[model samples]
Target chain A: MCELLGMSANTPTDLCFSFTGLTQRGGNTGPHKDGWGVAFYEGKGVRLFHDPQPSCSSPIAELVQSYPIKSKTAICHIRQANVGEICLANTHPFVRERWGRYWVFAHNGQIANFSRQPGPCEPVGDTDSENIFCDLMNRIHHTLPRDAMPEQLAAVLVELAEEYAAQGVFNCLLSNGQWLFTYCSTKLASITRRAPFGPAQLKDADVTVDFEAETTPNDVVSIIATEPLTSDEAWDVYQPGEWKLWECGEVIASGKRQR
Target chain B: MCELLGMSANTPTDLCFSFTGLTQRGGNTGPHKDGWGVAFYEGKGVRLFHDPQPSCSSPIAELVQSYPIKSKTAICHIRQANVGEICLANTHPFVRERWGRYWVFAHNGQIANFSRQPGPCEPVGDTDSENIFCDLMNRIHHTLPRDAMPEQLAAVLVELAEEYAAQGVFNCLLSNGQWLFTYCSTKLASITRRAPFGPAQLKDADVTVDFEAETTPNDVVSIIATEPLTSDEAWDVYQPGEWKLWECGEVIASGKRQR
Candidate 1:
C-alpha cells in the first residue's frame, strides 16, 4: 500500500504548504520512497512531474516544493515497490488522452495476478497500475458515447470498479480534469477546510502553516490522504467500502458501504 | 493506473447492478485483469476480498457479483501491474490497524525510486504500493496525536502528499470508516447522485439499471473513476492539482492545485 494525497479548493490555491509536509514521508518520515509524482490542474490543462527517486532527496521534488503552481485541484503520491521493477515508466499519476482530454491516475494498493493483453492503450512501464490505466481508457473509448454526461460515466465506472474490487484490494483516486472521484476498500481519510481557516502542523517534518493567512473566508479547501498528515487538524476517516464524488471542492454525491 | 468502482446510497445498496458491467473490463472488455479486489463497508467494519485473477473470469469475482453485500460504501478495483509480482501479497485493499480501527487502501499508479528503510512498519509484499502503505502507517504512528481532530490530520496529510507528488506520480484513495479523501494530480473524475434517480447503462458491458427502481427519493450516492464510466451521466473531472475531503456521501472540504 502507498500513500495518497489530493486537494480541491474553491479558489485557486497553492499546495506548496501542504506538499512540503507530504514529501518528507517519501523517505525521511515514512517508507514510501521508491519514486513520487504529482499533477497540478491549471485551467483546462495540467502540469505533471514524476521521478523514480526517493522524494525526500529528489531534486525534482525539491523544485516542486519551491514552485507555487496554483490550481483548484491536485494529486500526489510516493511509492514503495510492489509490482514492476523500479523505473520512471512505473511512476504514479499516470497520464493519458481520453475524449480529447488528458486523464491522470495514481494508486496506493496492489492487485494480484493482474494480467491483461495490451489493448490499443499500452503501458509505458510494467507496473500493474499503468496497465490498469490503459485498460480503463480502452474501455472508455469502446463503451462511452463521445458526449457522455458525468453521471452516466460515473455509473459505468462504478460497474467497472465493482468487478475489479471483487478480484482484490481496490482503493483508488481518479480524475479527468473536471472532478475528483474516490473509492476506498480500506485505510482512507480526508479533511475539508472552509471559511474559518486555521493553523496546521506537519507530522512528517517540523513545519507549520496558518491557513487563515493563506486563504480567504470564502475559500473552501479539502485534502485527502491514506493517513492524517497533520498533528493538529481534524481529519475524517473513510469507512471501508466507501466512496465519494467531488466537484468544485464539494461532494455532490456519495454511497453507502458495500458489504 | 487501475480501474476504480464505487457505490453510495441512502440505503445499503448492492453493487451487483454496476459490478456486472465492470467485470467485463477485468479481462473480456478491458485489460486490468492482473488481479481484482473489492470491499464492502458494513457500518464501521469492512468486508474485503482479493483474487489474483482477472475479474472477468475469477470465481471469486463472480461470487461477489452474485452476492448482494449491501452497505453505505463500497470500493473495488482491477489491476494491470506496476509494483510487486502478481500475487496475493500484492493484492490491494490493504488493511491496517490505526487509532483502534481498521484502515483500508488501494491504488492505481506507480512510483519510481520509492526506496526507504522500513521502520517498525514493513511491507508484506514487494510492491511499491504496499511499501508506501506501511510507510504511511509508520509515519502516522509516530506523528499524529492519537486524539487529533480529523481536519487537523488532513492538513498534515496535504503537506505530506505535496512532498510525495514532487517526486513522482501520486494519485490515490484512502479511507478509515468515516470519510473518503481523494487527490488528483492528473486524471480523476467523479459523479454524485442525490434525490432524483435515473436510468444508467454501462459503457464496457451491455448492462443498465434504473436508480428510480433501486433507490429512494432521499438516497444520495456518489461514484469516482479515472474516466467517465457511463455514456449518459454528467461526470465532473478533477483539476490537475486538486483534492477533496468527503464525509456522509458529500464533499465537506477541498484543496487547491499548485504547480
Candidate 2:
C-alpha cells in the first residue's frame, strides 16, 4: 500500500519530523518503495518536490529532509506503484492550476476499472489516481462556479468522494492554498497539536521531537496520515466513508455516511 | 534586465556549469537578483524549482547546481522583478497544463498593459510574464486543435510573440516536452556542439568545462541564452524578432520577422 501525510496549520510550520517518519515507509520500515512526492503551499503559490527514486536513498528527498520549508498547508505521498508504471510523470502529489489558485492532491488508495477521458483538465501520466483527480476537476469545472463558497465546494467534493469510495478504496487529501479536505474510504488518521504541545516519538524511526520547542502556545497544527506517525500521540482514526473539511487547523465540517 | 538560459539536447545532459554561471548573475555578478527558476523536462514529466530568494544564496539552487538532474530540454530564468513583487507566485519559469502536456516557459523581457484575463488556462502567479503566457494559452486553445502539428503551433506562437513585442520586450523560451521554441525580440544567442567538443570558459564566473569528458562522439547538444554564456565559444547571435524551433539539438524551423 501507498502512504500519505498532510498538514493544516494556523501558523507556518515545517513537516521535517512527520516527513522523516513517512519516508521510512518508502523502502525502510514499509514496503512502499516506488516513488515519493510532496507539495508545500506558500500563500497562493506552491512548492513541489517529486522524485521517481525511492525516498530512502534519493538525494532530493534528503534535501527535503534537511531543508526547513515552512508552510500553512502540505500534502505528501510515498507510492507503491499499484496502478501506474514507476516513472517521474506518475509520481504524486499532482498539481494543477484552477481559479487562479494551485490545487494540490495526494492519494493512498486505488480504484478499480477507473477509466475516464479528461475534459478541461488532463492526466499526463497513466495513473488511476491522476485520472480520478482529472475527473474530479472536470466535474468541479462543470458543476460549480469559480466563486463557489468553501462549503459548497466541500459538499460537491464529498459527493465525488462517496462515488469513488463506492468503486474501491479512495483515501485522499486535497488542498487549494486556503483549506484542506480529507476523505477516508478505508483507513486514515489525524492528530491536532495546540497549546500544550508535547514530545512525540516516531513508531517507524528512532527520532523524537518536542513540539513545544518548535511552536508557540496559540499555534494550532493538525496532521493527517494513513497511520499515526507517532506511537505516543493520540491519533483520531477516521472511519470508512468519513470526510472532513479543515481550515486553519480546525475541523469546520465532518460527516460519515454508513456504507 | 533578466537573463535566460535554455538547452535542447539529443541526449539527457546536465546544465550544472552553465547554471552555475547564471546563478552568479542572480546576485553576485549581474543584477537579476530578485528571483530565479528552472524547469527540466524528462519525458512527459517536468522537474521545476522556483525560489523567491536570489539564486546566488538559495540552498535549493545550490542543490540544483550539484545534484546533476539531467534532461533533454531545459528553460531557466533569473528575474529582476520588473512588473511583479518578489514572491513565489511571481517567479519564473511559470508552468501550465495544455492538451495533457505540461508547458514550461520563461521570459527575459517585459510586456506592458497585458491585462487579458485567463480563459480555461489560469495564471497562479501575478506577473506580466504569466499573464502573457495565460493569454497565449487561451489563444492557442481557441486557435488550434489538440493534435496540431509542431510547425502549425510555432506559426501561431510567432504571431503572438510579434504582437507582444509591439507592447514591449518579448524575448522568451517555451517547451512542451517535445521541442523547444525560442523567440528573440531583442537579444538571444545559441551554440551547438557535436564531435571534437572542446573546453569552454564561462564569461560571468571562473569555471571551465571540457565537453569531451562529459559527452560521446554522436552527441549533439545545443544551448540558447540571452547572451553568450561562454566567453571562449562562438555563439551565433539572433536578430531582433528572430524565432527558432529546435528538436534533438538541431534547428528544425527558423524565421526572422523584421521589425
Candidate 3:
C-alpha cells in the first residue's frame, strides 16, 4: 500500500507544513517508502516534481518541502511498490494531456488481475495504477464532450470509481488544474481549515502549525490524505466507495456507492 | 529567439557542463530571459523541470545545475517570448505521450502566420511552436502506426519541418527517448565527442571542461544547441533546410532540401 495527499484551496496556498508531515510516512514513521511525487497546479500549468527515491531521503523532496510553491490544488503520493518495480518509470503521479488540459493521476492500493484494452492515451509505465489511469482517460475521451462541465463529468467518474472498487482497491486522486477529484475504495480522510482554525500537530512528525496565524478568515484550505495527517484536527473519514468533486476548497458534489 | 540544448549519448551522461553554458544565455549572456525548461529521460520515464523565471537566476535551475540527474538523452530550452506570454504553460521543452512513449519538443525560432487544424493531441499553451508540435503529432497519429520506426518517422518529420519552415523559422529538436530528430530552419550546431576528446571552453560562460578526463574512450556523446556552446570545439553547423536522425550520438541518416 501507498500514501496519498491532496489539497484544494480557494486561493493559492503552500503545502509545506502538510507535505512535511506526509514525508515522514514515506520512510520515517511508516513502511510506505519506495518513491514519492507531487504535482502543484499553477493556473493552467502544473509544476510536477517526481523522485524515484524515498521521500525522507530524497534531495528533490527536501527541496520541495523547503520551497514554498503556492498552488490552488496539489496532489502527492508516497509509494511502497507492491505491483511494479522501483524505478523512475513507475513513479507516481502520472500526467497526460486531454482536451488541451493536463490531467494528473496518482493511485494507492492494488488491483489484482487488472486488465484493460489499449486506449488513446497509453501508460508509459507497466504499473496497474497507470493502466487504470489510461483506461479512465479512454473512457472519458469517448464519453465526455470537448467542453463538458465538471458536474457533468462527476457522474461518470463516480460510476467508474464504483466499478473499479468492485474489482479491487481504487483509492486515487485526480486533477486537471481546475478541479480536484478523489475516490476512496478502502481508506481516505480529509479536513477543511477555515475561520477560527486552531493549532494542529502532525501525527508522524514533531511539528505543529497554527492556521490562525497563517490564513485570513475567508481563506479556505482542505487537505485529503490516506489517513489523518494531523492529530489535533478532526478529519472527515470517507466510507468505502465514496467519491467527491472539489473546487475552491469545497466539495461541489459527493456520493457513496455500495460496491 | 530561443536557445536549445540537447544530448544523445551511448552511455548515461549528465548535461551539467552544457546546461551550465546554456543557463548563462537565459539571462546573463544572451537576450533569452523569458523562461527555461529541461527534460531528462530515464528509461521510459521523463523528469521535466519548468520555470517561467530566467534560468540563470532561477532557483529551480540552480538546483538542476547543482544536482547531477544523469540520463541517456536530454532536451532543454531557454525561451525569449515571441508568440506567447512569459509563463510556465508557454515554456519550451513541452512533453506529451504518443503510443506510450513521451515525446519532448523544443523550438528556437518563430513561425509567422502559422495555423493548423485541431487534432487528437492539443497544446495547453498558445504558442506557434506548440501548435506546430500538436499538428505534427496529429499528422503522425493519422499517418503512422503505433510502432513506427524512428527512421520511418524521419521522412514525415522532414516533410513537416519543411512545411513549417516555409512559413518562417522552425528550428526545433524532438525526441522520443529512443532517438533524436533535429530540423534546422535557420541556426543549429552539433558536436559529437568520442575518444581523443580534449578540453572545451564555453563561449558564453567562464567555464572549461576536460572531456578527456570526464569521458571514457568508448563513450560516444553528442551535444546540439542553437549555436556552438564551446568556443574551442568544432561543431557541425546545419543548413537552413537540413535534418538529421541521431541515435546513440551517431547520425544514422541526414538530408537537405533547397529552399
Candidate 4:
C-alpha cells in the first residue's frame, strides 16, 4: 500500500507541516520509498512537483518542505511499488484536463487485475491507478454535462468508487480545484482545524507546529490522509465504503456506499 | 510576447547552460518576466515546473539551474504577459495528453482575436496562445488518425501555423517526446552541437561551459530558442514562414509555409 494526503482550505494555505510528516513515512519511518508527487491548486492553476526518488533523499522534496507554496486545494501521494514499475510515468497524483478544468487524482491501495475499455481519456502510464483514473474521466465525460452540479459529480464518483472497491482496495483523493472528493475502501482519516486550533506534534517526525500562531481565526483547513499525521488531533477515521465531498475546508455532502 | 527554449538530443542531456542564459531574460537582463515554465520529458512522462514569479529570482528557477534534470526532449517558456494576466493559469508551456502521450507546447508570439469552434480539447487558461493550442489539438483529433505519421502531423501543423501566423505572430515549439516541431513566425534561432565541440559563453550571463568535457563524441544535441543563447555559437536563424521537424538533435524535415 501507498500513502495519500489531501487538503482543502477556506483560504490559501501551505502543506509544509503535514507534508513534512508524510515525507518521513516515504522512506525514513516507513517502506514506501519508490516515488512521490504533489499538486497545489492556486485559483484555476495547479503547480505539480513530481520526483521519482525517495522523498527522504530527494532534493525536490526538500524544496517542497522549505518553500511555502500556498494553495486552496492540494493532493499528494507517496508510492510503494505494487502494481507498476518504479518510474516517473508510474508516479502518483496523475493529472488530466477536462471540462476546461484541471483534474488531479491520487490512489493509495491496489486494485488487482483491474481492466476497463479504452476511451477518449487514456492512461499515459502503465499503472492500475492511472487506468482507473482515465476510466473515471471517460465516464464523467460521457455521463455528465459540462456544467453539471457538484452533487451530480459526487454521485457519479461514489458510484464508480463503490464498483472499484468491490474488486480490491480503492481509497483515492480527487479534486478539480473547486472541490475535493475522497473515498475510503480500507483505510482513511481526516481532521479539520478552525478557530480553536492549537499546537500539534507529528506522529512520524519529531516536529511540533503551533496552528494558533500560524493560522487566522477565520481559517478553516481540512487534511485527509491514509493515516493520521498528527498524534494530538482527533482525526475522524472513515469507515470502509464511506466517501465525502469537501469544499472550503468543510464536508458539504457525504454518504456510505451500500456494500 | 514570450521567450521559448527547446532541446532535442540523441542522448539524455541537461539544459542548465542554455536555461541559465534564458532565465536572465526573465526580468534580469530583459523584460519578459511575467512567469515561466518548463517541461522535461522522461520516457513517456513529463516533469513540469511552473512559477508565476520572475525566473531570475524564483526559487524554483534556482532549483532547476542547480539540479541537472537530464532528458532527451524539453520545452520552456518565459512570458511577458501581453495577452493574459500575470498568474499561474496564464503561464506558458501548457501540457495536455493526447493518444496516450503527453503533448507539451510553449508559444513565443501571439495570435490576436483567435476564435475557433468548440471541440473535445479545451483551454483551461484565458490566453490567446492556449486558445490556439486547444484549436490545434481539436484539429489534430478530428483531422488525423491516432497513429498518424510524423510527416502527416507536421503537414497539418504547418497548415494551421500558416493560418494562425497570418492572423498574428505564432512562433511555437511542440513535442510529444518522439519529435519536436518548431514554427517560426518572426524570431527564432537554432544550433546543433555534436563531435568536435568547444567552449561556449552565455550572451546574457557571465558563464562559460566546455562542451568537450561534458559530452561524449557520439552525442548530438540541438537547441531551438527565440534568440541565440550563447555568444560564440553560430545559430541558424529561421525565416518568418519556416518550420522544422526535429528528432534526435537533427532536423529530419524542413519547409516554408507559403503565404
lDDT of 2 by residue, B1-259 (tens): 7999999999999999899989999999888899899999888989989888999999999999999999999999999988878988888888888888999989978787787854888788778899999888889889999888888988999999999988999999999989999999999999999999999999988899999999999999999999989999899999999999999999999999964
- The 0-to-1 C-alpha lDDT of every candidate, in the order given, reads 0.73, 0.91, 0.90, 0.93
Q: What is the DockQ of each candidate?
A: 0.01, 0.77, 0.77, 0.79
Rank order (by DockQ, best first): 4, 2, 3, 1
Assess the local accuracy of residue A147 in candidate 3 as a C-alpha lDDT between 0 and 100. 85
Worst 10 residues of 3 chain B by lDDT: B111-120
Candidate 4 has an lDDT of 0.93
TM-score of chain B of 3: 0.98
- Candidate 3 runs further than 4 Å off: none
Q: Candidate 2: where are CA atoms >4 Å away?
A: none
* Candidate 2: tens digits of C-alpha lDDT, residues A2-60: 99999999999999999999999999999889999999988888888988889988898
Task: State the lDDT at A60 in candidate 2.
Answer: 88
B100-144 per-residue lDDT for model 1 (tens digits):
344567666777778754444455556777667667766776778
Q: What does the lDDT read for residue B128 in candidate 1?
A: 74
10 residues in a row with least lDDT, candidate 1 chain A: A95-104
- Candidate 2 matches the true fold with a TM-score of 0.98
- Candidate 3 lDDT over residue span A202-231, tens digit each: 998899899899889999999999999998
RMSD of each: 27.1, 1.1, 1.3, 0.9
Give the Å error, residue A3, model 4.
0.4
Candidate with more favorable, higher DockQ: 1 or 2: 2
What CAPRI grade goes to candidate 4?
A: medium
